[model samples]
Structure formats: structure tokens, C-alpha cells
Target: MARASTHPRSCGLKHRGFGRRFALLLMPLLVVGCAWGSSSETRTGDRAVPDPDASENVTFYPTYGYLEDDEWVVPVRYWVWEDRGLVSRVVTRVASSMAGLEPQQVETFRHRLRPFSGDSEWRQRVTFVFEDDPLGQEYQVLDERGRAPRTDRNGVVEGKVRIPAQRAEELLAAQGSQGGWLRWEAVSRDHSGTGQAILVPSEGTSVISDIDDTIRITEIPAGWSVAVRNTFFDEFREAPGMPELYQEWDGEGDVLFHYVSGTPWQMYESLSEFLFHEETGYPEGTMHFRTVRKNLVSISTWRDLRSLVSAGAETADRKYEVIAGMMEDFPDRTFRLVGDTGEGDPEIYRSLARRFPGQVEEIVIRDITDDRTLRPERLEGMTVIPAETIERATGPDAIVADLRWQPQSVRVLW
Candidate 1:
């Protein structure tokens, strides 16, 4: 078993002295989701759960850390933020709920960002920004014996304990206890947030999927209005049959999922609500967002949607870097890159395929735009397929089963 793990102080705390370096001694892992219990809703303003926010509000974007002295040095990345214009009309609402605004206020905010006047969808998405995650805020690490009150989650952390490398692996080996993870439970007299680290398994198939257009029905290339309509409005439509297809892949042997997108860290909870919802039910995986904007004053106008396509090579570069790092981190594990021509996913995969020829296995690019024409030369290693064709896939291995898809007929992402 690994020793008690410690999470170093979170970012944006450079100035303080006395309460300088707090470390969390994470308890043995718990499977994320459905451990909701308020120590009883201590009300303040609209919020219920005291000053503490649950996983529904506080999002964790955990990545595996390198092994140090035989134990895995796991870094748990978490954030706490006020809804700003986010959350619900009533504090009773959580996750995807955004603050209600009148017509004038919403339009005023949208007009500052886009020349176009706002619509209902525009207003909904426009106000979807987090009140900056407080800088210089202090977070204390929980003791080894700290246990958050649990409702129904079995392994929902009764006592905290350090994880040794061997112990973590053993947990992964257990039949029903399988899946790569190291969960952290937080217990504050005021707030509650429990996050888990996605451990990089020794040998497993990893799928690095894209969010926009590829999995979610986000017509980013369809213009700004379409993108906004899709981002915040509705519970989010799946890209045809991606949710079912992804679940199939999840059941295919030992598969781990990762979503790399231009979506900012602020939208983590909202996105999580869509992806992890039992209705949509995409595999539980680590999400990596592009920008981490502190304040939403400038962005409150819903301008960030333009980054979907207009972000240029900067978008491709960031995705390439993320995918490359993943392949490098787990050389033995093969990866299937699934993306759409909606974003520069094909080009990003092309770059990585060349760099890590051995690690990157199949490149699947989905095309749904009206103008379906991608240069075959640019997508040298990718297999362009229609959504219907992929939906026909039986399992992960069958993803490229019908590679009759031609790149020459794919949409070219800006």
C-alpha cells in the first residue's frame, strides 16, 4: 500500500506566510458520484450546504503524478468558485443552473462581446461564467481519520489513509472494484468537496475523445449563435449516438477515457452534469479544459464561444500537447484518438500520430458539417467515418470496423 498521500497547496496562494503549505492526506479511493449528504442544509443566502460546496459545484481536474520513492505522487487539482452569473434561480439548484437575468441585462452583456443582438439561447449561454476562483484563499488538508458523512455510497471513504503504489494497483485488480482511481474526500466545517485522481494504469486501452461536435452536439463550426445555443441551452444533445458508442467502448476490456477540449475549466460542473448524467451516460473520465479565466467581466458577454473555431493553430497546439503528454505518460497503453472535423482534431491527431507512431493506434475523425471536404493528405493517418457508421460499431475494436470512410469527404475545421 502507498503511504498517506499529500496534495500540495493549491495554485494562486503565493503571498501568505503562516498558513503557507497545507497538504491533504487523501483517504483510500472511493468511486466518484452519488455520495450526496448535507451534514443538514445549513442555509446562507441561496446555498444549502453551509459554506461548503459539493462535487456538484467544486470541480476536480485530476491528473496522475510521477512516482516518487516507490509511491505515486498524486496531484489533486480542484477549484472553488462563486456562481457569478452561474448556478440556479434558487440555491436549491446546482450544477448547470445559471443566474436569472432580465432581457436588458442579458443583452447588455452579450452585446459587449458580439455585434449580434441576443436571443433566449444567447442570454442563457452569455451569463454562464464563474465568479473568479478566489485567489489567496486557504484550504486545509483533511486528517487521515477524516470521514465525510455518507448516504448510500459504500466505499465513500469512512477513514482517510495513504495509498502505496502496490495497494492502489491491488484495488484496480479486484473484480468489481476495478477501474483506475484514487479518490479524495474533503470535510470542512463549512463546505464539502471530494475529488479523485485518475491513475494511469499499467496496461489499458485509452480513448482520448473530443467534446465539441465529436461527442456533444456542439456545432462549433456552425457559427457563433449555433455554438451558444448548443453549449448552454437544453441538457446538451449527444453527437448522434456517441453516448451509447462511448459506453460500448467503456465496456470493451479495460478502457480509460479522457476528454480534451477548448472548453474552459469554469464549465466543468455543467459539462460534468451533461456527461455524467445517467440519461446521457458517457464514461466517467478525466476532463482537460483549455482556458481557466478567473473573472468573467470581459468574458461574461459570451465571447469565449469564438475560441471554438477562431482560436486558430493555438487550439490545435494545445490539444496536440495534451494528447502527446498522455501517450508519453503511458507508453505501453495504446490510444484511439476520436475527434470530429468540427474542430482541428484531425490535424491535431495527425501531428501526434507522426510523433508517437507506436503509442497512437487508430485515428477516428467524424464529419457532420454541410461542407464535407477534408484534404486526404493532411489527414494521413486518420480514418474519416460518418456518425452512422461509427454508431454501427459493436465495440471499441469495431470502432474502425468499417473504414470505408473517405477523408476527402470530411468537413475542414477552421
Candidate 2:
């Protein structure tokens, strides 16, 4: 009886050890299953949550173009945001950057991540009303329907509207000695929001001015840190006497001021605000901006990373393309190219002057860098004046004297 009991006890101990081993092996799988379940639930809940701060505020970005026979076409684009709040936007931007998703993927994810943020097709009908004189009389809003915003590769929707133009010569003649601007306002029928556009005279000397380092302090040649700080964190600071120089150049408001920059179009709102608040006396003609890549991190950083890598060669090429297009668009009007030495502006301007012989009147290079390599060489017919000489030149009288076309009498502000 004692031997039989011992055998049964031994078998029971063996069975207990096997059960412990099995439980140890199954424990990891159970933990993994629980983790996966929790994650799935969290994702589902996130998909169900609605965006509370979505708004219908619209933004406009106007481009310059001239129509045939004294008619002008101001091509304007608008953008509608799902959420304008800073924190929500930051979160969205981070998610967008990390995912590196395509436009369609982004649209799909918008519902899963932020259901109330709306899709890329969310477009509102808007109407533009011209308030100022001469312009109101000359041009009318031919098409009242605002375009449905289409998403670009970067998931940015650009809605377009062209403000029609007619009888521009008559409008210009009416202004006479008193120079003024034609203003128009755009308002959405569905949303309580508005945007403005200013039209300048297309005739006379067209001044193509560079924005970074030339007009605003962007320290491009200094280094990346300074450039990034100035662009994102620091306040807008204009170059000394640049506003005065621009005012003098626009004597009698005949000169058309077109701001051309290598800065991406994303910074348009901030730059426009800076221009408006600074009171630069610069007549808003047409704003030309660079094409941006479809990357949220690069966009959020204001393209500072790319800027550091670029050696100004690519920027010069872009500037040339934009300027050359302008020259082709307005063949009759003479151009005055204004830029700084931080980039290849001097070299680029010189090449442009050579390419368009009689069309390019002058090349004004602001010597931000004391580099002697950019010394002005006679570029046949066109005058290349340094900014230092411009400051001492004593207003329009002295400045015009340096130009090829010296009028008998010039407007003197100083």
C-alpha cells in the first residue's frame, strides 16, 4: 500500500511541473494580445473624436498678369483652413510630417484622425466687391463664382478667381498728377471673412525688388541660424533707407513695384502683413514667390534646411525664370532690377541685362556684403549703381542723373 501511494505522488508532482512550464510560455502571448487590443481601441476612439475648432476663414494670394490691349488680369488664389488654432495646427502638422503621406492618404487620414477637419473638397462660394474709384469704374467682377479649392501635392488647396480688367488706359489717364491705387475686397457668402487686392499701373518703369536681405534683413550669407531666427522668430526689419529709395524711384507713382523673392509662397501672409504695417511707401504691384516642396517638416521650418544647403545658384536660376517671364509678358515697359549681393543677384542681374538689351533700363544692387568681387562693370546701356551711392545721390534728381533716360525735370522728394 505504501509503494502504490509513492508512485501516485511522483506522477502528481510531474503534472504540476508541466502545468507551470505551459503557463510561463503562454504569459507573453496573453500580454501581447492585451496590448494590441488596447491599441486598437485607442485608434478607434481617436477616429471618432470630432475637431472642435474648425473655422471657415479664407486667405487670398494675388499674382500679377497683364491682358492684351490695355486690359489687366489679376489672378488671385484663396485658401480655407479646417482649424486655424495654433495648438491644433501644430498637432496636425506633426502628424502630417511624420506620416509623409500623399494628398489622398492625407484626405483619408483626416477623417480617421480629425473627422470634423473636413476634406480637401470643402470649398465655399465667395464674392469680390471693388470699392475704390477708377478701378470700380474700369473693371467688373465678370465671374461671380469662386472656384472649388483643389489640393496640391502638399495637401494645400488653392482656390482661384481672376479680377477682370478693361479700359486701363482711360483709368491711367484719369489719375493725372494725383497718383492712387485701385483696391478691391473679397468676401465669402457663407463665411464672415474678407480679403483685399491692390492694382498698380502697368506702364512706366517696373521695379523688380528682391525681398530677403535686400528689403528685409534675412542675413542669408551670414549663416543658417541667423537666417532661420530672422525669418521665423524675429520681427521684420527693413534695410536702411530702402523705403526712401523706393519712394524716390516711384516718382509721381509712375514706377510699378513688383516684389519678387525666392521665399516660398507659404510665407506670403506674414510678408504681406509686414509690408502693410511697415508703411514702406512701396506700391503693391505683383507678388512673385518660389515653389515649395511637399514636406510638412520643411514647410514648418520655413525651408531653412534647404536654404542652408543652397549656394544661391538655384535661387538665381529661379529669379531669372520669373524675371524673364515678366519681361516677356510686358515687352514695352522698361525694367529696373533691384537685388542684393548676398546671393548671385549681381551676376544674375548682369546676365539679364545682357540678355534683354534695351528692355532692362538699370540694375540696382544693394551691397549687403562688402565682397569686392561684385564691383560694377559696364554692362552696355544699363546702369549698375551700388546702394551706397544711392543713399548719397540726393533723391530723384541725382538718382535719375545716373540712369540712361535723364529727364529735363524730375520729382525731388529730398
Candidate 3:
């Protein structure tokens, strides 16, 4: 205007190219100014944006791993119930999200915790559910109400609802004769036997095994020295060439593999699945896990039985129940009870063989101790195998005592 601002740097506002460069230089300043004004205005009167941290109330939420976007997590519960006279612990992983945690998480946790749970005695109900209204809201209210109670960071809520042992057992066994929540049903092992089963012509021979050290190697929690020994060493291992010997026996005779473990029925699937998966060395159809009952009656007295009965003989009741069930399924089967001298297997099997004389023809036990003072009085009529001899006999090419040892030649089918 005053001679058109004579300096070359003083570009006219009307000049489009010069104006474009000028606007570009001012763009950052403009954006900052707008943002500043918008923030001030928002603080003064406009609606505030949501605070993600404030809205998230996850302090009381149970510790869990991540989940993907838009993915639905299912809730599952592992119910422990009394099946027949024996307590059958089955996992019924439900698909609802109202229980407590997700089923996948529950299963993962179970898998992780199982190896360490070899000696746990407490039977507490574990529930899996989702984050929801009502129950989840109740958790929120409790958290809010008890915020000032000063928790121990370990999340032990003080004065929690503690159910007495008797009452808890009652609740767990309230359904029917086979009490409690019924959900999981494993396909009958016989029905699910492999399409290609290795079959030998009928010989009527059956194999019985000890539970604790013979098959499972559950490092029993004894004293620290014993615990260390059990932990570092497995008495439950399949002794050297036992599996191959059993396989060859299965190939030759109409043999059945029976595992007579001292492990409780609560460990049925844990032991069964482990043997089936990890110890595939054993013959397919010949597998069993001894189920036991532990009832705490008085201060220093507990009725422990392998077979389940209505009253008394808890362990025997469980064993007899399973053995009876097997008899019902497979009649004319002759069993040879194999056990170790260590725990109650020898005594228990002796009682069983005496009870069912026709069914149990032989009783073989591994002599677990060298102490001459502890040598058991050999039972009449039943064959007791020395531990060393049995170890040698389990090798693949070892000659069987006799083929005619089996009473009858039964039709061997898968």
C-alpha cells in the first residue's frame, strides 16, 4: 500500500504463492492455539473426556492373564463327587461365564498345579465364572466397603465364610446315591478301546499291579529325608523293562493289565491320563488306577480302604467296587494280584484274594525291604515274588513261569 511494501520479504497478502508459505509456517502455531483454547474451554464448561484409569475398577479382580478382543471366554467348574461307594472326582468344564474364572484358565491352572498337589488333603470347591453384574457387582461392593480393613496384600479376606468340614462334605454329596453335581462322563474305556487291539487267543490270564511305587512313582510326602528321596527319585516308575514284559505277556496270553496303586481315587484321571499318555509303554487295554477312600472318624482314627462300602472298609470298598465292576463286565477272568511289600497293597490284595479265591489265583509282591526282622510271614497258597527276581523277570525275553498258569482259554477280543 505504501509503494506496496517495497521490500521483497514483505509479500503482499493478495499474492497466493507467498500467502501459502506464510500460512504453512503459522499452521503449527494455529494448531497449538486451538488446542490450548479447546482445553481451557473444556475445563471451564465443555464435557470432559472419559478417564480410562478412573473407570477401570480392577483392584479386587482375581489375577488373570490376557484375553483377545471380542473373544467370549467360557467358565468351567471341576466338581468332586461320590460315585457309587467310591468318590469320583471329574472335571465338568461348563460353558457359562457366571462361575468365577474362565474354563481354559481353570484347566491351565489345574494342569500347572496337579504335579504339586500330590499330597494336598483339603477338598475345596473351585468355581469358574465371568465378570458380570450382580455377583461381580457384589464383589465391587465388598471391595468398596472393606477398603479400610487393611488386607495383607496376599488377598486373604479376614473372617471369610468358612464351611465346616462335615457340612462341606454334606454339600458335596447331596445329589443322589452317586451324589453331587453330575456333568463329566468319560467314554467307557472298553467301548473306546482301539479299533486295532492286539489280541491273543484266550488264555484267561490277568495282570494285577501295585499302586504306589509299581506304576505311578508318587513321591510320597514323608519326612524331609524321605520327601527328598521321593522327590529326587520315583518309586512309581515302570521298573526297567516292565512295560515290554507286560506287552509280550499280553501278546502271548489273554492277559489283562490291572494297576493296583495305593493312590486315592481323587487321582484317578491324573494317574490314568498320565499312564495312558506318558507311559504308553504299557499295553493299551491293560491299565488301572486303584481308588481309595479316606474317612476321618475320630482324632487319631481314620478308616482307609481301597474298596468303597456303605460303612467301614473305605479303601477295600473302593477296590472291591472297581474289581466287582470289572468282574461284572468281564466274567470268567482270573486275576493275579501284584503289589509291593512297602505299603498296604500286600495286606489289601491278600484280603481281596482270600475274599474272591476263584477270581484271584496268584498274589505276587516285590519284597521291598532287606531287614530280616521285617520279613513278612509268607501267605499260604499265594506266590510271593522276590523284588530282585521280579525285576529280572520283567525284561522282554524273560521266560514266563508257565503258559498253563492261566486256568482257561477265553476268547480274546478288543
Sort order, lDDT high to low: 2, 1, 3
lDDT (tens digit, per residue) of candidate 1 on 39-109: 22345686655324422233346455434456654534444322322112211131112323234333322
Best by lDDT: 2
Which candidate number has the best TM-score?
Answer: 2
Off by over 4 Å in 1: 1-57, 62-69, 83-163, 167-176, 295-309, 370-374, 387-414
Q: What is the lDDT of candidate 1?
A: 0.48
Write the residue-wise lDDT of candidate 2 on 340-377 in tens digits.
Answer: 76666766777777778888888887775544333435
Q: Which of 1 and 2 is ahead in lDDT? A: 2
RMSD of each: 17.4, 21.9, 29.1
Clashing pairs in 1: 1-164, 2-163, 2-164, 4-162, 27-161, 52-190, 52-191, 87-97, 373-410
Clashes of 1: 9
Model 3: CA > 4 A from native? 1-203, 218-236, 277-280, 286-313, 328-331, 371-373, 379-381, 388-414
Span of 10 residues, lowest total lDDT, candidate 1 = 23-32
lDDT of 3 at 244: 62
User: How do the residues 256-356 of candidate 3 rate in per-residue lDDT, one tens digit apiece?
Assistant: 66564434334444445545554446654433333232222321112222121111233344444555444444446687776554444555666666667
- lDDT (C-alpha, whole model) for all candidates: 0.48, 0.50, 0.33
C-alpha TM-score for every candidate: 0.58, 0.59, 0.38
